[model samples]
Target: MSTMPTLDTPVTLTISPDGGIDGRSRRYEKFLGDMAGVYRDAEAWQAAVSARGADELVYWVDDHRYQEGPGALIVGTSTLLPGRIGDEFAVTRGHLHAIADRAELYHCLSGHGVMLLETVDGQSMAVELTPGKAVNVPGHWIHRSVNVGDEPFVTLFCYAADAGQDYALIADAGGMKSLVVADGDGWMLTPNPDHTGYRKA
Candidate 1:
């Protein structure tokens, strides 16, 4: 548990009408889809990308990358774009911590979604989230979130900055071994064939 700092100089965060974090945020427009580079579906994927706009804004990362000694903490909120990649919902580019023993925490601020977690040791899980919910991400887990609601999904996070992220691992693996998708009125989990070489749970 970390305490809020008593600052001589007050730092402020402002949220725009569209949920953007003022001054301290980055946006990603080229988010890879699950079908990206699937040779068989290249045409379909290309059409979708063209129709939807290839550089559609995927997510907004707002953070105060503050260092407190050798150990540091990052406070931020990720606002996920609302839409689907084929049948799958839009998701964050997930990552595993470079420092395998480090953990992270997330608190849902608004909208609805699911958080996916996996480990090198063959463990995997998905937790649903909504406003006001908090989740503790244990060490050694690779994690990401998917927006399942109609509106933009947003969540606040606090994590060890020392636990640098290794995104290449997940990208090289073609993303998580499972995915959450729209199933009728709700959503369901489905295995990602691209990740067949990896274990799920």
Candidate 2:
């Protein structure tokens, strides 16, 4: 079973006004309360990162089980380093397992890239993404992104589902396969019986 990260504990703060406080002082007190809330939220986010570790941004769960089952929200951000000359990652055609929920969304935080998206029925499309652009991956659709520019690719990923459920799972086409490695010469692709084909970059 995959070890899931624990949710951050909540923090609460309360402020009481004094009977003799002036209007400006009251306003300042309110501002302090607001700042406290912001600090609490940031602390919670940091705790989550500490529990999950920084590597979750790039760790690929190649061939793993969805221990949380289905329908859970998993929010994360990821950054991909620049590929060496002639380096490539071949992506296989597959569908996300969480079909009952809304589609997964990816917002590009920086860099330039293209994502190949295909329907379960074989229709294909490509989306060009740059900084500040967002793309929604329809549930059960086959999609993969490739960095086509010189810089490292960065993105904010949001997967929505019920608590304690798997955020996403890849369903491979009949025979399609993919390889992600540092060496450019190690990748290859093949045709799948389910009407999808894989290619190496």
Candidate 3:
């Protein structure tokens, strides 16, 4: 009988702070049109689609997934281009890990941003990150990346390989519990009126 394949060998990854890895297994891109219904300002998003063209690149992720199972890890970089839609800044689609209890770590590679976090139980937090800063996001939290600066918000992230993202959770709840908006020269978190609270899976 044929033998099962052996496990993967350890490898060195040359990661770039600007959002890339030398041995990335895949790259995913999100365009302006792909973000419909994500921002609270519907009118602004529509106007942006008209002015910038629907296919404009909004963000991209490069990741390396070497294995699968309980102990495997997925490493990657997220690059979010800076922009504004109404009073809100550019943000990732956001998600809750499918496993629910899987945690994550994000290290700021460049630019200024915020890690917007919220829990199903009404807990909310916004942690600002500059180059060299990092956030260890605990499990059970809904998280997203917000770009609050003029440069691309880039971050290096790693999480359990089995921690698949539930992208529809936020959409089902009518958006997250808070919105990150401009506060003069800074940024602030305001309640999202449309949020209907999270529904347990």
Best by lDDT: 3
What is candidate 2's lDDT per residue for 1-201, written digit by digit as tens?
Answer: 899877644333221111111111111111111211111133643454466453433212111112233544445444444432223332222334334334767777777655656554445666777887989886645556555556656555556533222212332233323323233433323223343342211
Question: Model 1: clashing residue pairs?
Answer: none
In order, what is each prediction's RMSD in angstroms? Answer: 5.1, 18.0, 2.0
Q: List the residue pairs that clash in candidate 3.
A: none
Model 3 TM-score? 0.96
Highest TM-score model number: 3
lDDT of 2 at 80: 46
Q: Is candidate 2 or candidate 3 better by lDDT?
A: 3
State the lDDT of candidate 3 residue by residue for 76-127, as single tens digits. Answer: 9999999999999999999999999999999999999999999989999999
User: Which has the higher lDDT value, candidate number 1 or candidate number 3?
Assistant: 3
Tens digit of lDDT per residue, candidate 1, span 33-92?
433643123465677778866666677777766344345677777888777766778777
**Candidate 1 or 3, higher TM-score?**
3
Stretches of candidate 2 exceeding 4 Å from the true structure: 1-72, 84-95, 98-102, 161-201
Ranking by lDDT: 3, 1, 2
Question: How do all models score by TM-score?
Answer: 0.81, 0.45, 0.96
